[model samples]
Target: MEKRRLGRTDIDVTSVCLGTMTWGEQNTEDEAHTQLDYAMDRGINFIDAAEMYPVPGRAETQGRTETYIGNWIEARKNRDQYILATKVVGRSEMTWTRDSENLTRQTPAQIDEAVEKSLKRLKTDYIDLYQLHWPDRPINGFGFHSYEDYATDDMVAFEDILGALNRHVEKGNIRHIGLSNESSWATMKFLQVAETNGWPRMVSNQCVYSLVARRFDYERAEIAMREKVGLLAYSPLAMGMLTGKYDSGPTPKGSRKDLFPTFLGRYDLAKAAIGDCNETAKKLDLTPTQFALKFVESRQFVTSNIIGATTMDQLAENIDAHEIDWTEEMEKEAHRIHQSYRSPVA
Candidate 1:
């Protein structure tokens, strides 16, 4: 229940942020609302969602996640009590998000349309932190580990994207901006553009960081410390791999891995590393979930750890992970695991 400053902004958000990407796909509306109520009661003050959410990204259930949050806001009338963050889709072929195009890009006009729709769906006048879900350039995000450079002239300029977000800040539609699934070079480039053009600076970079995945620690950690754009780490549990549920037996029924096996295929290469982590947790007299969550929370560059769940028990366990006292032995064990695996899931 500790709060941290979001970048250089005046807002102080909880270190644990409730993630709602499973609202409409794996959970119902009522379940989503119950999760929200319980999270608020537990002192979580930040909620993160996206326009192209409830993942699997089908045309049928695209925006239902925001609609669920909107209904909760309408019913509770407690919009002022928490910080809200959502995202706009970057360059992709999932064109169902927009009305006019078959591809989604971070162009100025597309940003305008995306922000308006998100506001209407969230039932809010302004978003505390609006994020670009990914970069406009052609790069492998979402679990790929290859690097390929594309034609520079083929992509939208970073200045145009920041300029568009600045217009939203000026109009009171968004209070701040952030990035997701971005690289260190691009993060610095965005900051440079903002400083040179006198535009809004990015407040955070939301990415995947867990015990089994340490890609953010390589170079972005320094940027986070120096530039003040700290990390909002998602999937800190490695998409349920760190919970020890899969270590002993078959996949549990209705779990994320069971429902969408292909989505978490990135962890396949790190199966041995994950099993080692679970064993390390037991040696430390802690559950794998607690160990994994605390390691992400203990990082100096982490602004908030985004936790998601489809059931009440899972939600409670994830939130309670904040209470664990990080010990020296735990840190050393984590380092041993890292030295052995060395970002197997990255």
Candidate 2:
């Protein structure tokens, strides 16, 4: 696995980051541990989790994902081997994350509480890369393409959020900070604030970027290249749509689509484009999973491609995808797919 510097930080994370969003929901603690062991053996040095994880986030299963990672860290005592990253929830109604707050925001109190709880749950003194899960502004994130015309006069200032994260950095609770599900404008704003205030800068922007979803390529790619805050791309397989599992048959049992189809609704609008991408992969004599994963990995602005799985087979295949040498032919085919679809799922 190739290593890249996270932003301008000294931490060098593997190009393939192991994502742990499905651990407590579709997988057990033992399974999560096994995945961690396998990922480490495969030279994946980066692991990403969030306080509000195990998607389709229920109040009952909210922090179980971090707890599973914490248990693995405790049992293995190998915290120094990999770069650990987790997130603080942005503005949302999933109030179960905090003790008394009904709405999650990037307030100093909420950021303090969230980081303390994540450190306790992760069983670590410091996180390598702590991330803001999303902005605390009124914007339609998480696969919604159209901008919601709404007032954001009451949104928390970016300076305040960065100030809170700065305190954590100063205290050694977090080594660096990043962003997720953010826009180009927001990224610039955060960068400006951090630079002007001499605070910690964002190291990466973790967002959805797959063969079917190219929203990051439009404006953020340039920002990533110039600013050094490269992309830690999540959902590189478009929530499993780019894997060809649903191309010609019914949704497989125990799959994400079968368990919670609504979460992957963005892919529904790109069905034709996804099928075409799968066919293009076959035409190139490659599996759709390999094709999709490699395309994301090959991008110049991608610092790491976050891959997640619920089963051992899926985990093995996703990790093995790093071995595929992305050729000119594959790039041409991917370009053709992009020209046709033009970010259908964005």
Q: Which prediction has the highest lDDT against the true structure?
A: 1
> What TM-score, computed on C-alpha atoms, does each candidate reach?
0.99, 0.98
The segments of candidate 2 whose C-alpha lies over 4 angstroms from its true place after superposition are none
Name the best candidate (by TM-score). Answer: 1
Q: For candidate 1, list the clashing residue pairs, or say none.
A: none
Full-model lDDT for every candidate: 0.95, 0.92
Clashing pairs in 2: none
RMSD of each: 0.7, 0.9
Number of clashing pairs per prediction, in order: 0, 0
Candidate 2 residue-wise lDDT, 197-230, digit = tens: 9999998999989998898999999999999989
Q: List, residue by residue over 208-233, the lDDT tens digit for candidate 1.
A: 99999999999999999999999999
TM-score of model 2 vs. true structure: 0.98
Backbone collision tally, model 1: 0
